[model samples]
Target: MRAISIPLPGGPEVLTLGEHPDPDPGPGQVLIEVAAAGVNRADVSQRLGHYPSPPGTSPLPGMEVSGTIVALGRGVVGRSIGDRVCALLPSGGYASLVVAEAALLLDVPDSMNLVDAAGLPETLATVWSNVFMLAGLRAGETLLVHGGSSGIGTTAIQLARAHGALVATTAGTDEKLAACERLGAVILINYRTEDFVERLLDATDGRGADVILDAIGGAYLDRNLNALAPRGRLAIIGNQSAARGTVDVRTLMSKWLTIHGSTLRARPSEEKAAIMASVRENVWPFVVAGQVVPVIDQRIPFAEAARAHRRLEASEHIGKLLLIP
Candidate 1:
């Protein structure tokens, strides 16, 4: 199997393409012949030695992929070889082959492009788990998604809108914000030019958002609280900025706000399986009906994985990027 390996923690240039021993399925796992792998900010962090793979997981950096099952391990039931599937992985998605727990795999419909399916698992799991499952974003509520043009952001916009929530988003550029708008974002904040907290407050008549999906981490924590309505929920999935932030405890207590932080990569397999189950039950219908779709910005060749990292780091692309193996 060929994979992009991070031999050292450094820049994108350090991602080396090399042949690795083929991985076989273990108990309750399945071997997948990869079609495409999703490129995410976490991958870049891993390359830079900031996020290491979870213990006993693949050292290679990649968390999601779409492929066809080639073999099934013992104790794996209700799945078979040749099934088209997308899987959430702890690591090792950037390769020609990967071994995944069967419970974490979702069936990819024949109608959807297999390569594009690669982009769905991680983002969908993250958004569905944090925003809906954890935050309990109800219909008619407002959801303010930071980085609205990102993979998580785009998925959040569509899914929230489909679930009957009003969507607001922050992006750095007009073009990106426009993309968010087209995807159902009603309030667009150019984070580079405007204060999102103020804008969100104004747009909601001072009520602010009922739920906020924030990836900016500590840098936006205080403002995120300010942007929320009373009893609002804030789900933080990434710390793209500094990890630490000072919070105003008074505001949190006064408003009865809730803040949650999580990462999908390091989660236990059973937990990921539960999240995937929820997604399949609640979100997959929307996907099959085309109400929710994977928004891909670019597809880079597997050998040129470095280019994908560069594009993600530069923030030059909106939506998901894929590596074709």
Candidate 2:
């Protein structure tokens, strides 16, 4: 099998396609013949040495894949071989073949093509776990999102809206904000020209947002709390700008806010399985119904993985970017 592997951590040039041993399914796992893999920010971070692969996981960069199941391991049931499935892989998505736990597998919607199905697992899992499961984003409440142009942001926007919540998102430009609007985000704030906290407060009629999904952690910490409603919940998934920043505990105390942070790939196997199960039971129907769709900005061949990394790093894309293997 051909897989993109990084010999050392550095620039995108480190991502190279080469022949590697094919992976086989172990107990409770399944082997998929990969059709496409979603190129994610985590892949770029892993390439640059910031996000390391989990212990005992493959060293490959990809975390999600869409493919046909060619083999099934022992203890796997319900799904069968030759099924068209997309799955959240712990690793090994950059290859032609990947092995994933059966519980993480999802049946591709007949309405979706291979390229589109490739884009679902990571974004859906992220949104379901952080926004719905962890934050408990209830209907009629306000949800504020940073990085509105990102894959996670787009997915979060649609899911929150579909669940009957009011949504707001912050982007660097109007173009990106407009994209968020198309996905049901009502309040759009250009983080560069305007203050997100002030804009959010104004849009919510002086009542801060009930839920906040933030990728920018360090510099925005204080402002995020200020933007939250009383007893608000803030779910932090990434620290793209700065890893550490000071928080005003006095303000948090008065507001009675809850600050929760998490990463998907680093989680324990059982927890990841639980997230996948929730998606299968709750969100997968919405995806098949076409209420929320994957917005792909570009699709590059698997051999051009470096170019995919460059585009994501540039922050020029408004939606998900993919790699067709």
Candidate 3:
């Protein structure tokens, strides 16, 4: 198997495509012949030595993949060889072959391209777990998604809209904002020019958003609280800006707000399986109906994995990027 190996923690140039021993399935796991892998910000963080793979997991950077099952482990049931599927992985997705847990697999419909399916698992799991499962975003409520053009952001916009929630988003550029708008975001704010807190409040008649999906951590924490209505829920899934931020406790007390900080990669396997189960039950139908689609920015060759990292780090992509193996 050919996989991206990080010789050292540094820049994107450190990711090297090299031969590796093919990994085999273990108990309750399956081996997949990879068609493509999703590129995410976490991959870049791993390459830079900031986020290490969890104990006993693959040291490789990728976390999601689409492929055909070639082998199944003992105790795995209801799955077979040649089944088209996409899976959430703890690590090791950026390879020609990967070992995935059977419970984490989601069936890939024949109508969808296998390569495009690679981009869905991670983002869908992230958005579904954070926005729907944890935050409990209800119908008729408003959802404010920060970094609205990102993989998580794009998925959140569509999913929220499909669930009957009003969508608002913050992006850095006009083109990105327009893209978010086309994805069903009714309120689009250019963060580079407009103050999102003010815009959100003004658009909602001073009630603010009912739920906020924020990736910009420290830089936006205080403002995110201000942008929420009473009893609002804020889910923090990433800290792309900075790790530390100051927030007023009074805001939480006054508004009875809820804040949740989470990460998909570090979660336990059982928890992930539960999340995937909910995603398959609730989100898969929308996907099958073509109401929710993976917004792909580009697909790069596996050998050029470093270039993919650079693109993600520069925030140049409007949605998910894929690595073709």
C-alpha RMSD of each candidate structure in angstroms: 0.9, 0.9, 0.7
Number of clashing pairs, model 1?
0
Q: What residue runs in model 2 are displaced by over 4 Å at the alpha carbon? A: none
In angstroms, give how far residue 138 of model 3 lies from its true place.
0.6
- Candidate 3: which stretches are off by over 4 Å? none
What TM-score would candidate 1 get against the native?
Answer: 0.98
Candidate 2 on 139-164: residue-level lDDT in tens? 99999989988999999999999899
The whole-model lDDT of each prediction reads: 0.94, 0.91, 0.94
Query: lDDT tens string, model 1, 18-104?
Result: 999999899999999999999999899899898999999999999999999999999999998999999999999999999999989
Determine which window of 10 residues in candidate 3 has minimal summed lDDT. Answer: 238-247
> Clashes in candidate 3: how many?
0
Model 1 lDDT at residue 122: 94
lDDT of 3 by residue, 34-110 (tens): 99999988888899899999999989889999999999999999999999999999999999999999999999998
Q: Arrange candidates by lDDT, descending.
A: 3, 1, 2
